[model samples]
Target: MKMEDYTVEFCPWCCEEVVIHAVGITACPSCGKPLAPCSVCWDAHGGCREPCPYGCAGAEADEQKPVTTPPITQEEIDFVMANY
Candidate 1:
């Protein structure tokens, strides 16, 4: 089969098996859950191209996406307990 015929199938979020067929290039299905376009690899995802990092579950893009939530801090927990 041709390369384009192949699909980079993968659910951007749930890690489900989603097909990135020739036509599926634009973006994944925007179902109930929020969707965001791949940040690092924009439209290039077309043609079932390179694999995505974190895969994004196809949510909407944003100027500021933490991408990485802050690690839990002991001081913060302590304060919460103190107040309680």
Candidate 2:
């Protein structure tokens, strides 16, 4: 069966077999294990954030925060101009 086909579940955190709904992907109702989408050494979005549809917290796995574009300020522009 495919991953999605896993209607039944084993919570990685609790590591016990669990009852899953038609499309559940988060906590195990029994043990409350936070399940997440597993990728190649990372979550698919390239951040520590849970990729699981249910957004289950996983193995302290993601250490990196998401990258963001810093806001540009007029002072920053002036500093760049002065330096350049």
Candidate 3:
């Protein structure tokens, strides 16, 4: 089997995997992260062609997510105890 046939691309910024099958990509389709030109190789993932170690799962989920509630801080707890 050819290695080129099973090559995968990963986002350099978010470390998300790209699902599409293509080469010479300028940006990651998953996270829209700008891809850097590999200095040593011309393939989609340079010579390694391995999945990102960071393992983002899916960057698109992060991009489309909305802001959630903030966590309580120590200051808030201290203030409540002091006031009470």
Q: Against the true structure, whose TM-score is highest? A: 2
User: In model 1, what lDDT does residue 56 have?
Assistant: 35
Q: List the residue pairs that clash in candidate 2.
A: none
Native RMSD of candidate 1 (Å): 17.6
User: What are the lDDT scores of the predictions, listed in order?
Assistant: 0.35, 0.40, 0.38
Best-to-worst order by lDDT is 2, 3, 1
lDDT of 2 at 28: 48
Per-residue C-alpha lDDT of model 3 across residues 3-71, encoded as one tens digit per residue: 232224455556764332222324444455444323323447445334532222345543333322232
Error of 1 at 23 (Å): 6.8
Model 1 Cα lDDT, one tens digit per residue, 1-84: 233332334444566533232322333332222223333245553432244443433335521233232222445334433443
Superposed on all Cα atoms, the candidates' RMSDs to the truth, in angstroms, are 17.6, 19.5, 18.1
| Tens-place lDDT digits, model 2, residues 41-76 | 245667654444444354465222221223324454
- TM-score per model over all chains: 0.25, 0.32, 0.29
In order of listing, the candidates' clash counts read 8, 0, 0
In terms of TM-score, how similar is model 1 to the real structure? 0.25
